[model samples]
Target chain A: MRSGSPVYRRGAALALLVVVLIALPSVVPAFFINFVMTQTLMLGLAAATIVFLAKYGGMVSLAQFLLFGVAGFMYGNAALEAGSRGLNLGWHPWAAVAFALAVTTAAAFLLGALASRTTGLYYLMLTLVYAVIGYFVFAQITEISGPSGITSIKRPELLAAPVSLYYTALGLSVLAYLGFRALGRTAFGLALQGMRDDPVRMASLGFNVPLHRTLAFTLGGFVAGLGGLVNVWWNGQIDPASIGIGPTLILLIIAVIGGVSYFEGAWLGAFVYVAMSTYLRDLPLIDRIGITEARFNTVIGAIVLLIMVLSPQGLAGIADRLRRRPTRPRRPAAGSADETEAAIRRAQLIDE
Target chain B: MTATRRRLPVLAAAAVAAAAAVWVLFLATDTPAGTVLDEPGAFVVTALDAVTFAGLLFVAASGFTLIFGLMRTVNMAHGSLFLLAAYVAVGVQQAMVGKTRNIDASEVGIADWLVPMLAGATAAAVVGTVIQQVFLQWNEGQELRQALITLAITVVLADQMLREFGGLAQRMVWPGAVTHFITIFGQRYATTRLFMLGVAVVIGVLLWLWLNRTRLGMVVRAGVDDRQMVRGLGINIRLVFAVVFFAGAFLAGVGGVLGASFAGAAPGTDGAWLLNSLVVVIIGGLGSIKGAAAGSLLYGTVVAFSPAYLPSQYSFYAIILTFGLLALVLAVRPYGLYGRPA
Candidate 1:
């Protein structure tokens, strides 16, 4: 993924990162492993969807949660449950998951078709309106989600335990990250970036801009669908609050704060979000200031504003700066080495 | 002249047809199994309620539209400003109570109400100006970032307001004389609504005159059309923008004060009013005074009638219906009725 001495360093970093993540459960406290990491993975997937669309499609979709919600609702409807609500079909867990994924992907494709026709602010507004409409439809229709919520979902044997569930979620997220990386190396991904830069030019170059955008949106939706599965499984219940603007905004805050320019920023942002929400409210200083959990949004909002103003590229940008720091001061390398190393450095930046 | 003359009959016929359809729908859906004229009278009550609601909404939404048209920035914090103003009104009224020991605020003189209203408006205007100067001015051309910044401001403001105001719903007490109910079609209605309606008309006329007849209004209109030209022409565009923002915020404050007198102020009022104002501006045509007025009336009427005419279970559908209408309008006319395509 890199060249020269830096290549070894990056490889070492990647290996370290992998080791840390895999051993996190055993190394960290149960609270951190069970709650923080689990949330970070799931929420990261959702945020990554935003990052994908924004980075490649140049569109900010506020309705990504609709896909998540649709999947959750489908899972709720099909999964095993008690009570006379009759909303649940009590299907096999695998079957329910499949059905939810299929429906969510299809719905996302349709929404993508409608939304991709617009650009800029109109697209943002359209997606926002759609999300609001989706919220109302899901909330008002008691038969779908039930009056209260759908609970007591049957998890498959492999995914029954919390630790196992966390691992499964982590595996899926890693697979998704790898899949996205693979996609980014493809011709379609290159064309998608070209489209984001200038749609008219891409269209002139024989790219179907709308189709490209729709495909990206669909891919993003699929990733979000996976997150929805993890989310529903973790909670063992689904409700409007899970899919509403509040949580959606939280995801947006995470994505933006982490930095949308890079895909890994999604996970980084989610980690910060989960950590802040999990830990910030209990702090003595915050408690003394009377900032209860109810007023938690204030802290998140302030952080978002600070990040937007100070570093729109977010934590990823900061990480990048730190990575590039040592290289910048070592400009006294031999002239021949500099000439040969230029292309490799450029390749490294793009690959990362 | 000939075209205008020819349009009169068509307009009249369309009006008649619309009225007939409304009457038919009202008779079919709203009439209870036992009541005859009660439902029809209730329609009048709802209509009045709608008009009053439209009046208050117009004040807030027109300001929102004005800011958007001129600056090309969607101020998400407008709702927070409205809520802030409402809280200010409530605070002012409470302070009045402390000074005069007036347990029954409705018995107080007109100055008691006027001072609070003025304070709310002034506070909102000052805050709006500060926001424009401090936060919005740097990111003038970037719409999405600016919108997010405003959202952040909104969230922060909302939290602070919630902390200070607590979760309770606070209402401004209107003068006792205007608070009295009058019988209209056997339905008791407050005279305060009539007063509010009068205020709306006066504000509308004043705004029209300001925009059309005044130098600043002319400059604002010009700026909306071409900001660069206004800047190049040696006009103080920044000052004009600041003034317009102040006026817009002042109107929101007025709306908050007026609404608090009837609807009361609560924690989520900012989000609700922001959504309502967005719908109004989107429907009415962004940046158009007449459009804001029309959109507000339609939205208000829908909100008022849906709850009254539709089954109680579907009462919440009023918001959905308004949104659906906006969607339809947007689908057909993406720029809104009066809005120009970008």
Candidate 2:
């Protein structure tokens, strides 16, 4: 139990995290528990959707926020009572949630199909255009979503308490993290990784590369929709401004800051972003510099730029470097490559 | 055989499109009485508006496509450069005339306009060069990194500009020489718009000549096609990259000045113009000047004409039509009309 094996260490870390989270509401102030912790969990979940796509699928998407917004919008429109400025379908809240997730998944699948035709930077541009177009469409279609958006989305009685909501968000985040971790070990996930490494080779190996990409994108959308569902319930409303380019970019910034390549980095980045945005302006140094809340974007931008320029791999990479610093470098023995090649050839011959 | 076969559907689509256009422009009578189709004068005005706006979009997009072609960097800050130039031009114009707003248009001379334009272009060019050299140069071949850096620069620039210039929409006073209205086809058109069109044509011709006849332009074209190969040929590609970036930024600045005079420059125009450039380049084909021109004209036409011809109740759907054009063009030619795969 006290061994220094990596698996044990990982298990211990996770258990400690669970214990800390479970005990947090009791120890921390209500404001911290409700606002900061809960908000961080929700944003972390949202950023996780981006991390999953980027890390596993080798696709950096700007449309995840749009999908999140879609789910919220669909849910709001479906569940709003009559006389509201939405579709006012008056469906049960649970049913609305299911419908919203379904819609988001389908929309993501379609977007993935269209966008998978292009790769790399083009993929980014296409998704960006889609998001921008969605923004305009939502803004212009005032009949469906009023200029101000839908409001008065009531949460279920079970999650009415701030602590319960916080715990729910925490549980969802943990599940999502574990699910993504497990997915990465699955055959489909490995194939997706291989496709990311070299799509042409994967396709030549008889893999349906586009289908896998689309499926991965759809899964990301569903997860993002879950985040959206919780976000709407917490905020009790959804608006165009919430899903605009500003929020879109902030999500990407959060993912990059946390470590786009690591699943855990999503929440880590979210925690930093939420805390900074909330408290940065109150800092004595920031106040003395005359940088008000209005100028917060500048600070954030500078930080992102610094992070990108210094370490493209993000905070996770920095931590990884720090943790591995004590390990001694091993020098390869001369002629080992020849022996390995001969062994591989012998194994291949035996298989044949 | 495949080329001809592909061309057939495209030809058929164009014919159907042309027929639809004719029906909308001349044959449609169910539209409201005051719409463009009902009035020939309105039709001419809208058409000219489309062309002038297309010229402006082309000017802004040309530089973007060039940089994208050579560097494979989207330069998301291109719109920021444009907006910055506009604000600078407005500020300089106001300072020269010693008035913040409502300066006498008669007193503004060519120097007043020309000086501000030059100042704006110079400022934008300097900023653009600095961004490229400082942030993007070291990360060559890392397209995503370059894009993200530019996006950060855009956010910072936008915030700073908003702080400095405030939220008011500002327009540069046009030169007295081109402030009058010119009549064409018996429809009065703003002379400033015609002047803009003329400037666009001049710039287009100059760029075409440079690209076809100059040594540096040849290298740029070659770089666009195969950058690694061009670098392997012992050419100083970094120098070319800097020169192209400078020119591109300079063009954006010019566009800023022109756009300010055409329509007022405001806080959110950066995002709007950025979207416009993206759509234009995507429609035309990435990295192709001719494609930019074609895409701009088509996009401009859709934007200008969609609202004019749509029913009053459906006017809001004009935006949908614009994006619909994008979707259609993308479906037909994924690389765009004149674009080739990268």
Candidate 3:
């Protein structure tokens, strides 16, 4: 019944998905498990980053995928540079993540600052533009990155098993979510939310609105950077098709369907998306229905429309509301927590 | 009126776009490839290709800018809508000819007479309006919610399409006598392409007049600057939005139809076209027709010419160039090429 604080309930649900995901590689056949679990985790990371943008920053940047794409390329490039004898920059795969994260962070910092000035749909437009360019960069750059792609890409060292890679992705995603959670509670986080809902008032209060947004930009980048690395790691390669605008926007869809407002949204979106895409891939619905896979995008499109119409709050928001009513009377630690703890939790609710 | 007097920013944007175009041409000319870079004739051909590319891109982006600039709704479904319309238009072309759509530009001369190009565009508008009426009306000013809702719609539609249509890429074919190439500047090009370029320009001019000299355009501009204020002036904001949505969607459809005549509509066209439109609108200015035109041309030229000079392996160099340009423009001018300060 989720009979406790909404936080407890949410934690419980995420924990449940996590446990299921952890068990997947072993519990299910390796073939199906790897694809599903990896995709879910990657999207979960993407969606979590989006939550930071939506919940704290009041931004609707469509270009989260730009970070995702860049991060993937960074990973691929880092690997290639490390692996190539002529251009050796030897670092363990784990260490190479630093290179990728740094690039992603810098790009996010630069782009986010630009995007931070824009609100609502304008931000979305800028983000989309960034994504397109990122896609092109992914598709074109021969020496730097491109369509020919960075192949023969090996997985990171110290993560030997598919399960291990999945777990590292899972662990990092959790860490990122926690990082966002911690950040969302800081003086800066509060100031950013204040700006999100009311920038002029926050400015009147001398919060330096753009500064908080810039910090938020950095944080969002850091999280998305993690996603990019893991995404390439998951796919085991990089190419124009993988990194271009199409896949980038698709990642946005994954984040949105999962509910961009909270960390849970990412995992949820990943789950739904992976399940649906997997179903589409394995099933011969196109054959049975007499339509080609090229046209299968309608299924994704129609579902998105229905979700928009029927559940604007998304599955997570709806779950929270339901969790609030009828089942909240049973918490054991009611009123025992300090006021600051409650405030932090309340803020988490809004952001999440 | 006085903001219009502040013409420096607009001029600056023009300068930036011009500089980018020159940079691309310079690099393309310097490349070592024979067919790609050996001839002065090749650069001219490529530049023309860039112009056509920008023209088509402008058609895709104008409606997007209008919808976003005026109302702060980021319609993620916009791309899907364009893709859907293109798919529908291609279907129409195939039906009229009673054949599979090979969509070779070689076969397009007879198409003008068979189905007025306007029809496909009109169908897009109808679909756009219907989508707005049914899906978008209630979600008017809530950006994130709107984004999510539309995203859901996109996913569902994508799946439905895959189920209905096989994965094979389809094209809109032009039949018989119309399929011949029109040689311009001593290089062969599709006449349909020339027609498309003309159509895009004419439409741009007409749309400009509609917004500037016409009463409707004035209202739309006013609406963009301040929707609540426009309503106070006795305009039905809802109806205007519906119309804008229709026009925007219709343009996408027209682009889809003509686009099939060139690149062919495939499973992934929505994302590709959407990304290009986003770039055009962003570099230019959201919701500004002039901005979209400038941005489209900027992006179009990059698309046409980058492959000639950039290491073929690094072909997506244009994207980096775009981001670099966008970063520079946004850093210096946040409102895009022609967007007024908010």
Candidate lDDT values, in order:
0.76, 0.83, 0.68
TM-score of each: 0.84, 0.90, 0.80
What ranges in model 1 sit over 4 Å off? A1-16, A84-86, A106-114, A145-154, A185-191, A202-215, A281-295, A325-352, B1-27, B30-39, B99-105, B308-319
Candidate 2: list runs displaced more than 4 Å: A1-4, A325-352, B1-38, B182-188
Candidate 3 chain A TM is 0.83
DockQ of each: 0.21, 0.30, 0.37
- State the lDDT of candidate 3 residue by residue for A6-94, as single tens digits: 67866896688778867777778876767777777777887777777767776666667778767777776766654422123445677
Evaluate residue B131 in candidate 1 and report its C-alpha lDDT on the 0 to 100 scale: 88
Error of 3 at B268 (Å): 2.1
Kindly report the docking quality category of candidate 2. acceptable
* lDDT at position B161, candidate 1: 91
Ranking by DockQ: 3, 2, 1
Lowest lDDT sum, 10 consecutive residues, model 3 chain A, at A331-340
Preferred candidate (DockQ higher): 2 or 3: 3
lDDT of 2 at B194: 84
